[model samples]
Target: MDGLLLEILTAVGFGVLGAVLFSAIGLVSGTDETATIAPVTLLVVMLGAPPAAILTFWMAAAVSKHMTHAVPTALLGIPGDTLAIPLLQQATAMRNLGAPHIALRKMLAGAVISAFIAVPVAVLFAVILAPFGSYITAAAPWIFLIAAVLIAYFSAGRWSAVAGLVPFTLVIVALQAFTGTQDVKLAVSYFLGIAIGPLVAELFSAASPMEARRMNRSEYREMTLAPDVKGWGGYFPNPFRVLDRFQTRATAIAAAISSATFVFSPVAVTVIAGEAVGARVKHAYHRLTSVLAVRNGVTESTYIAEALIPLIAFGLPLSPVAAGPAAPLFNAPPRFTVDAASGEVNNLHNLLSVPEFLLYGLLAVALASLIAYPFAMNYARQAAVFVSRKISHEAIIGTFVGLVLVIGLWEGGLLAVFVILTVGLVGGLLYRVLGMNTGVQFMGYYAAVLSVPALMRLLT
Candidate 1:
């Protein structure tokens, strides 16, 4: 037991170190999830690290990545990942106003504040709901179905929601069918890339036309603290001034509710629930920022909570985000499976265990904030100057494209390269010509899932 505790602590230290290193990389390179966290975690796991260490490292990397990755999104027009897209409009606005620091401060502050609020809430929910584990397990399929429906409905809307449903169902069916015949595991990332490849390509193409206009000749800057820097004192805009910015009960309630549910994707929650809360507030900017922050908090919290719920309850991975990190922790396959006859899945690995994962997540959040806050507050100007001088957005984009190509090759061999190009063309047309959110492609992914099952049923 003592050894277990020691291992957990060691893992936490490793996590903090990994996060800081990744955060620095994210700031300079504008690379996100795939570039930063996945490879690092995979490497650690391959080294046969203890489960606790791996979990701590995974959560730490995730939390830390968000803290620093938001910098490019908030300061420049470039988004770090799909998760950071919601902040693009607001962050770009701030950047144009030469107050990119404001956007950075808001994102960093909100992340820290949300992490503080969310960790305890998640822990409480996990403890209270632990007793009903079996019941939750029994209802897993129904829960997933409902979650899928809700995500679809909210993402597309009621009338057009069917479009969303069809695609999701098709994807699942296709996946299941393909899995039965041939292994789809090797192609998962490639397929995911194909589904979203067009969107990425479109983004690059769109930026290409304006790239010359947006290029910065300045050097990149490092965040530095003012001589008067203090602990939490530096977090506020004004030390003595308390901004009632996020003081409303409704915002808190919405954030808490979203955190508890953990059903929809972060983007879905931000668009649906975030908009709903924004409509309720008085000041438009205040409401928008507050709701955005709340939504972001809920997204992060729910992601953490939902991952644990499945593992603690039925021992299944409920979401890809969870499975990605959890895979290394348990040394489990990237995919989960159930027996046909018993319909049961084995989830008995106890590497980091449930409580430890929860604690480590909390600790990572706290430690990341403690480190990031001062850097953001005091060194905003320096960081901005340094980044502008040292890094070129064009270089960043080239690096991203190269990485995507490598990932494509890794997933589907050379065939994925053509897949990416085809998708990129379509995505570019949809975004530039139609002005639609790229998320609509998610419908195609779902459709692929559903088609397989329907076909099987018909044939059988």
Candidate 2:
């Protein structure tokens, strides 16, 4: 086999391994990207793994975590994290019907199928578009502006969205001015300081005797499978049955488009796109879950595609998530190199060298789905029984919060712990006061970054 083929096979194997390990972790402790996969990516990058290998591992880990997150959301009525929050209602309804296994199976199947279908298409687009990378890079400022405007408009109605632009622009200018100092460490520390500002406020509040209760309490229903379907076979939720009821090509296309466009924040795109698609289709509530499943699949695929396309074609980090994993592919300071003769930017980590990473990543998703399906199916009945007999809904929330705290500490040290608390409080306040989701906050931050050039132009 050629090197590419060998790399593909190796990546697939790694993905399968990641699937089993992450599935077990998700089953016991439901956590999302930050806690479950980000740490691993950071570690692998620190260890000096090849960019292709690191990307392969990142894809495998992501697919594994997402595939298994469905279990808790379906069986326990407890979403793994923010990403799974949108599916909570549908999962609860399925679990109440003793079809938790079937729900999980459908979700896993959808993820696997979509990953397989979407990855290659995305890779092809990235490769074919590689020649035009310079033009794309040159347009980055405009793209960011467009993205920010779109996010603002979609997040709030037209008037409120327009109102939000002022603060967003101000924040970006402030951040850029502070970080543009000549001293590197000082600049980095300043950037980190800005990142942790919310955390500081939270710690002061938490230190007070008045402990803010952040726990969510919901009723847990014990799932009982129909007597006829009791084993591994239960894992294969009749996609045909589900599709017969909810499949609309228009919905799928909408979801896919939303996923493709919103590369910076896939989960937000999935939720908004799912809602839009659901409204357009009949049986909005019933179809919402599947709409989200398709959205989730498409978003993950788009994320990989958009991030990789920019990196391989132009050597630019389009999103924070992409930046984290792709950092190793280029040497420490990733840069764009233009060919003098043709003025074409060449990303050393182009599809010619990196296609195998995506191929293997999809293979891992397939393997994970296959293995996890049977186990999840069998466990669904047991999980229902166990929860009925032993677990309390409140206890699960407590455990999840504890896990989040530990993960926060791991990611940002004491600083991260503080930041999470701040983010939660501020995030909650933003929701309560401004009626904004975390997505809006993210948009504000990115928009802030793009505001620098506009400010500079005005000053000049």
Candidate 3:
């Protein structure tokens, strides 16, 4: 009773704290999930935060970030993050319509509503899948292989993305072999490389005289904000009052469907849910607003669902979100661990039960919705403009790079540094030129370790 009560208090306190931090971070344009959340959660695990607090913090941070993420998306014509990329078209349309304020409101309200709906539904679905956990673990290696191919083929790079996985996988395998011979094994280094690939590539390009010339900018980025408009009279308004019946239905249904599909790429899910909802509506203006709402709602729903379902049902990093930002929750060694040798999960699955997941998960969402929704709703214009003018993308990238370097040094000194640079440069170029994304690269990393070894054993 005492432990459970402690967890409950921890969840409430940290959930709100995470929301407050990431809510502000979300307004900054260049910060994405991998760059922002992954490193933060790693620290949470390393610092020995209890399991319940870590899970709650992860969900709360994601939900809050996605909520305020709409501020930049609608008002300043920039994507809030990877998930916000799909909402750009409709966000741009609404901006042109002189209704970025309405777009921002709808997006926030939609997120709140979908989060409420999705958390309960995702937990229920995860419980249903719980009985099959052993069976899923037995086939985890093969499932990763197939998922890698499918995600690669469906990403923006298409067939090129699929083909690129071949070389990427081989590179991972060779690196593992070399590291193992030296009695060193590194997973975080590989993940950091893939996550920061684009930034590292940009840094490299900026160092070259020829490429730096093309990258030079003469003017500061300019942004125009629509006048603030408020429909509700109170400090915090019910989301239903902000959304119409059709919009509410679309957001709910999309959230429900998205929560069930924790295995696919989140960006793909965002695009599909938006299209699924939008195609049914015919009016251009209504379609624009509703689809944008549904898409942003799907972002929170999918991230929560994807992270929670896999953690609860399988205790594995089965989803892209799980394999990335939430990976440390599943496999941070000496603190939390998922044994690669025996398919044993000794992380959150061992610490928290189903009922606890439901309880803490809801607390996280409620805390986020309570804080982020009202803040973004009230200060969308001011926050967007402030972030546009004050926040430095260079400084954010530099900070993350420094963190990565420190982690690499902690792991294996010069060897780790070499591995990080090699993977970052090669992976960044592939990602930039060939369209292969971090999600695909992550799966490729898993496939190299899991499937390749399994294949070799079978051949032998």
Candidate 4:
């Protein structure tokens, strides 16, 4: 009993830490989840934190970030992250209408409600799917291939992305083979390279004479701070009261449905959920607000579901979120791994049972609700102003670059560093030229590692 109490307390401590840390990170615009969350979570895993603590930390961080990400989206008219992109249209519309605060509130409210709904629903789905875990693991290679093609086809690049996968996967296979010749194995390098691809591409473009004019900014980017209006008396207002009956219903329904669609891309599900809900509303203002609520709601729901379902059911990085931001949880090398040849696994899936997942999952959500939700609700305008004026985007990008360099060198010295550079440069360019996003790139990585070996064996 004492040991169990200590474990629970430790999980709570980690959950709080994740919530506080990511809440601040969320306020910084353009902080991609894959770049920020994956590395940090990997560090936690590698440090030998308990499995329950790791799960809680990740859940709290993801939930908290989704809540506060609305700050920049609604107030500054810039997306807070990739997932926050789906909320931009409605957010910008609301900003232009002089009701950005209301938009922010609606988004935050939707996120809180949706997160609570998504946890149990996603776990239930995972439970149902758990019986097929063995079958899924056996067919993991083919499933990853099909999922890769489907995800690519649904991406912004569509057919172009699908075609791009072939060469992208080939590049990874080629890199692995080259690295193998040197008796070195690389995984985190590939993930980091892909995660920061766009940043690398932009840096290279900045140095090119041909792109000098386009890269140059004439003046400082101007941003207007939206006025804060407190409608309620307390620090944390009821999310239910913040949203209308219809908006609450829409958010709940969207969240529940999106939780089950964990196999799909989170951004895609978010867009579809908002569109599905928005089409039903007649009033323009109501439609915009409802869509904002549903979209933000889906962001929380899809992220939780994508990460949890795959982790709980198949112990594989099957979903895009699992393959990208949550990749470390599934396969962080010697600490956590998904063996390609045997489909053998040793990770959070085996460490934490279903009941523990449920308990820690809800605990993380509750912690985020207590910390990030109210903090964003009460101090959004101030947070937005500080982030805009005080924060240096370049510094953030450089920090991540330095972190990647340290990790790459630590992993396999110069060989790994070069592999990271090679993958980053090529993947970054492909992302910039084609509409092939990081999600597609991640799927391509999976295909290279999982599907390629399976194919070779079948052919032999």
In TM-score terms, which candidate is top? 4
Off by over 4 Å in 2: 1-21, 28-30, 34-36, 127-132, 156-205, 208-231, 234-354, 370-375, 380-454
- Which lDDT tens digits does candidate 4 get at residues 297-368? 999999999999999999998888998899988988888988888888889999989999899999999999
Model with the higher lDDT, candidate 2 or 3:
3
What local distance difference test score does each model get? Answer: 0.53, 0.51, 0.85, 0.91
Candidate 2: residue 444 Cα off by (Å): 5.2
Q: What lDDT tens digits, residue by residue, belong to model 2 across residues 1-460?
A: 6976766666665556666766665554234444345444545545555445556666666665666666667766777555577667766776666666556655655555555555565566666767886686676555556655665555534446546656645744553454345222111122222233333344445566665554232655444333224434445554434343444343345434543452455656666766766676676345655664665555455545545555555555454344332322322212223222232343435433555545554565566656654556556546444544676646754654664456555444554454455445544444334544434544454345443454456589
lDDT of 1: 0.53
Better of 2 and 3 by TM-score: 3
Query: What order do candidates take by lDDT, descending?
Result: 4, 3, 1, 2
Instruction: Give per-model TM-scores.
Output: 0.66, 0.66, 0.95, 0.97
Best-performing candidate as measured by lDDT: 4
Poorest lDDT segment (10 consecutive residues) of candidate 1: 223-232
Residue 14's lDDT in candidate 3: 81
Looking at model 2, the pairs that clash are 172-448
Sorted on TM-score, best first, the list reads: 4, 3, 1, 2
